[model samples]
Target: MSRSEWQKSTFSGASNECVEVRVVDGTVELRESDAGDIVVRTTPPKFAKFLQGIKAGEFDHLTT
Candidate 1:
């Protein structure tokens, strides 16, 4: 997938955010949107698990 096709998250409104992601070929690619050229890729399964953890509040202590 081309890096040019990656879209910045809509939630980043009015902020100089540091991240961007793209879904391609069943995997998700993450990168620093402003830094450019650096990327990390993860499979859908792992991403789903991360989301589940969030929903379950497993990381709640980190917030405090």
Candidate 2:
């Protein structure tokens, strides 16, 4: 597989500590900018569900 270009969120605003995402082989790839060596891959449907969960604040406990 070819290397994917990771993209940071537009809201990152010059911060090196942020999540990065890329699409590779039809899978959504995610990694932290501060720890690029590690990655998490998920299918499009699962990724969509994750995004929905985020919007629903399902993971809000992590921040508070």
Candidate 3:
């Protein structure tokens, strides 16, 4: 899928600086707000694990 087709996260703050993501062929694609139509893809499992760790506070430094 094209980055232009990706939807912005509803949880995004007022600032338009957010990433858009989509699952394609068992992979997750990510792109920054100002990245235009370029996307980076990662394995679904890896993305899930990363998300789990983030929810578990393993990536708390990101918020700090």
Candidate 4:
């Protein structure tokens, strides 16, 4: 992927540890700043559902 294609989280704010995302051909790619070699790919619909679950606090227990 090109450098221009990747996007970082707005909440990163100069932090070395942050999440980045890239969309290519209807697929979403996610990676962490601390682990650039590792990537997670998913479909747009699945990603949207995951985001909705996040907004609904479905993953809150993971952090706690």
TM-score leader: 2
Scanning candidate 3 in windows of ten residues, the lowest lDDT window is 1-10
| Whole-model lDDT per candidate | 0.78, 0.94, 0.79, 0.86
lDDT of 1 by residue, 24-49 (tens): 77778888867677888899889789
Deviation (Å) of 49 in candidate 1: 1.2
RMSD of each: 2.8, 1.1, 3.0, 2.0
- TM-scores of the candidates are 0.62, 0.91, 0.69, 0.86
On residues 1-64, what C-alpha lDDT tens digit does candidate 4 reach at each position? 4333778978889887988888877789999888999999999899999999999999999986
Rank order (by lDDT, best first): 2, 4, 3, 1
Which of candidates 1 and 4 reaches a greater TM-score? 4
Better of 1 and 4 by lDDT: 4
Error of 3 at 9 (Å): 1.7
CA RMSD (A), model 4: 2.0
Candidate 4 at 38: error in angstroms?
A: 0.5
Model 2 C-alpha RMSD vs. true structure (Å) is 1.1
Q: Write the per-residue lDDT of candidate 3 for residues 8-53, one digit (tens) a residue.
A: 8788966568988777766788888887588888998898898899
Pairs of residues at least 3 apart in sequence or in different chains that clash in candidate 3: none
**Number of clashes in model 4?**
0
lDDT of 2 by residue, 1-64 (tens): 8667999989999999999999988999999999999999999999999999999999999996
